[model samples]
Target: MLDWLRFGLGTLLMLGGLFVLVTAVLGQFRFRSALNRIHAAALVDTLGILLMLGGLILLAGWSVVSLKLVLVIAFLWLTSPVSSHLLGKLAVTLTDHPEREMQVDDPSLTRDVKEGD
Candidate 1:
């Protein structure tokens, strides 16, 4: 029946999402630098949420809960990147030696900083 088919597909999606989420968490611990951790988390945040919620919506059918899930996914997709960018900027600004971690391919992009400026 249609119900059984929906259940199977929804479960598969949910499981896949759970796997991605767990991997991201482990990646955070595996990566040492702040920028690397942010990269790990931000990379999977949207994809994991989308997969899990998309599965839930499918199982819930055409209902109000499904609509809310869609909205939540949209909100997260918008915010996750902004937050990640801010965190990355903070890491770059605070680090005493940004050069070791970051590379600027263009010499024109940066200005020389005097020893006492």
Candidate 2:
């Protein structure tokens, strides 16, 4: 029946979200640099959140709860990336670690202008 299909899909989505969240946490500890950590955080923000939202939507069916759930998901999707960018920028600006190397190839991080002509 439709109910069984919904339950199965919801369960799968929730499990996938949890898996992504665990990997993100592990990645934070395993990675050497802030940039790498940011990448892992982004994975959690995108995949983990999306999967969880999908699960919630399936569980709620077409109710008002599902509508609110979608709004929350949209807000998170918008804010998470912006917050990550700000945190990464702050880390790069404030930290003074010699061993810290950029793992993500950000053009802004690499682009430098010469002063003298």
Cα lDDT tens digits for candidate 2, 1-26 = 99999999999999999999999999
Superposition error at 39 for model 1 (Å):
0.6
Candidate 2 displacement at residue 11 in angstroms: 0.5
Candidate 1 similarity to native, TM-score: 0.85
Best by lDDT: 1
Per-residue CA lDDT of model 1 for 23-71, tens digit only, reads 8999899988887788899999889999999999989998999999999
C-alpha lDDT of candidate 2 relative to the true structure: 0.80
Report RMSD for candidate 2: 4.0
Scanning candidate 1 in windows of ten residues, the lowest lDDT window is 108-117
TM-score of 2: 0.82
Model 2 spans with C-alpha error above 4 angstroms: 97-100, 103-108, 111-117
Q: TM-score for every candidate vs. truth?
A: 0.85, 0.82
Candidate 2, position 47, lDDT:
83
Candidate 1 residue 83 Cα shift, in angstroms, is: 0.7
